[model samples]
Target chain A: MDYDPMVMDDAESLGPVVKISQADNVRVKFELSNADLSFANSLRRVMLAEIPTIAIDLVEIEENSSVLADEFIAHRLGLIPLNAEGAESLLYSRDCDCDNYCEHCSVKLVLHAKCTGGENMSISARDLVPAGDRMHQTLGMPVIRDEDGLGPLILKLRPGQEIKLECIAKKGIAKEHAKWAPSAAIGFEYDPHNKLHHIDYWYEQDPKTEWPPSEYVDWEEPPAEGEPFDYDAVPNRFYYNVETSGPLGPDGIVTEGIKVIQQKLAGLIHELTEGEGGDNYDGPRSPEYGGGGDGFGYSTSYGGNGGNQSAWGGAGGTTPFGQTPYGGGGNTWS
Target chain B: MNAPDRFELFLLQDGEKKIVETVVNGMSNCSDFTIKKEDHTIGNLLSERLKQAPNVMMAGYKVAHPNVPELFIRVQTDGTVTPREALVNALKQLVAAYGQLGREFQKELALRQYADQGENGDGSGAQGGTY
Candidate 1:
């Protein structure tokens, strides 16, 4: 909020004009007008990967005589979405000050299911009962389910089969594991007419018959059906259909995602103007190239930056660049 | 392969965490900035906004590799505004954009909730049609 740009805030004058066309319990439709695709994709990715949610991370099986394996049942438990209404207060297990995991970082949930008198019974997520001391918790008696109040069917059990386990639910982002993802569906559409040629339809006969334009074409002008297409059309509008996975509502997910973006940008702003009068901190001035604490690695020691290593830091040892190249787009929380 | 440190995104390490490493050309009034642990989200947003800033000649960005998180941005200004000023402008815009977005979303959510309460099962509003 600080780092005064000192100029007439023209970009702020334009503002990021986003409008919610419709909103409900599960989904919200919005239109971002006069903005770049980068911002659109950033919002989508942040909501998908940055916003934290509560999921079962550690499962201690006490008794398992059901048909499914322990790990299989554990994985299924991890996928169940608990109400993460106040997940922000929950500490990540790695960042907690406790020895391993304490009540401050994780919640203890017990799942005990037995087929007493049924031919074949289905153990559901409704059976996982919360048993912890989290006064700050907002999802105390929570299991996402349909309007019929029936939780997801986990596994089937025989007449005498029973399963009992203690699950530790922790806060996590989707980047580390997909089970923590808060959104059930996210529809991000730009350039629906394919005017930008971003999509390549592999049609043998006709591209039109095989690949019709996205239904979003009806929202805009449809490019006038046969108007001469301009190859240089940058998308100035984006449509989003965001649906939550019961942990957070549609608006909650979006607002949380927007907050994450703000935090990232603010952190960068703070670093950029940390020690100097930010007004004059014009360019990158890293005179302290290889200072203390190379805990990141020897790559922090730039003296070994030779001209030989691969550009992308292939399986080779090191590159001229200071950091090691990785394989996937990892979250900062990982 | 060893994964890059996850904390590299925030911890302003001296040797690492080159948030923005810019090389300014004195003669051409252009600069190239390399931001670490970032993807196209900020890259494209800043470049597009920088291109629209006053006294800015051109702005563009590219990722070094699909596997790497680094991003490269090249900006040429017309001497009126420095490259850093242009970047700051873009950053400020992004901040305001997100701020407005959050407020608008929350506002719309409240409005819908209130409306839904008044009418019973009024699912008349058509959403951005399911894909």
Candidate 2:
């Protein structure tokens, strides 16, 4: 309960890491200086809502003989977590130059199936096929998969039933929809303080007082002096957990979430400082200006704007854009 | 730790060691585990470190559910290394790098001198030099 001005100014730089532990690749635990709880919570929110992952955004159904309706099927498809390895290189639809959908901004997946035999069958995400030029990398890729190689079920079909549909996957954040959330669950808690109380000594003197969890008393080697219990203490340090929804590993989700936070901070700094003093205001500074330890205390040498690397990187391409998600009246059956 | 079990002991604020157990090992491409603590800082830090590990294909962690307070992390790695090994390496590397950064900061502070030469001087922090 002592005042320390230095603690507020450079807690990040000066804080000590007291402990760290991990359970293989699945979970890790670490303890550092207790700072603002809100700041720690912000990191959790960023991981759940800001990290970019690929999900089905627009769907066009040509035919449906299965039980699920077109809109219902689209909803199910949107929740699938696609492999987002190269998504950072791709541009967000809002940032793209195209008026609507384009190859640079979207991936096309088609699913066509029919039950010809007498036996009923189940349909899974594996049945969905990535179409067009990007097929090689995306074929048989599920939005998410379990360790057993099983994907979420899309629909079940009886004999003679069929379904044909086209889905467009795009990079987005969970703020848009739950489907884009990188993690299914995430949370953190404050570290607790413990104290030993000499209950036996107090009980012997005052027999009227009652104690719960009676086994806690140390009868074998009772100390001459009682240890003070810190029940009222509020710990500043926190621990958190992240359960991945499958498109990426939990670690990847956290890393991407941190990057997104850094980028947003960088964007703010660029916006506020760009036109202030320099008449040489370039159109828009690359988000990379925030790199090289701009805001985050550590050095991040991830050069080159940290955006998409392939098709989306180009500007003024002749590739024609497709119809808007809602502008087109109905699905184009072929 | 057996093939199905891996555990880590977390040193709590009260100096009590709590063991976090792995309930589900993602054999093919995932691993799921639980910890008693409710925390975002540790999970975020570990995941951030894992992302920088070499040969790590994908790494992820999450709370089990909205009602549950346990944490789970799953990591996938290239054939060259196991996910568990990759995570340990990441933590070691981060500690070393951060320690080095602290020393660098101290050195810079010692070498540089602060001056308050008023508004007459150009305020730009830029220094001119031939690379």
Give the worst 10-residue stretch by lDDT in candidate 1 chain B.
B122-131
Q: Write the residue-wise lDDT of candidate 1 on A203-250 in tens digits.
A: 999997888678578667766666886876778789999988777767
> Poorest 10 consecutive residues of model 1 chain A by lDDT?
A294-303
Which one wins on TM-score?
A: 1
| Candidate 2 docking band | incorrect
Candidate 1 wrongly placed segments (more than 4 Å): A1-12, A140-142, A200-206, A209-213, A276-334, B1-32, B74-76, B111-131
Which regions of candidate 2 deviate over 4 angstroms? A1-4, A9-12, A15-20, A23-34, A135-140, A193-234, A275-300, A303-334, B1-131
Per-residue lDDT over B1-131 for candidate 2, one digit per residue giving the tens place of the 0 to 100 score: 43321111111233221223243454654444333333344455556546545566677777656444345666776656765556555443433333332233222212221111122144221222211
lDDT of 2 by residue, A99-130 (tens): 98777767888999999889988888888888
List each candidate's DockQ score. Answer: 0.23, 0.02
- Scoring model 2 with DockQ, what do you get? 0.02
Lowest lDDT sum, 10 consecutive residues, model 2 chain B, at B4-13
lDDT of 1: 0.66
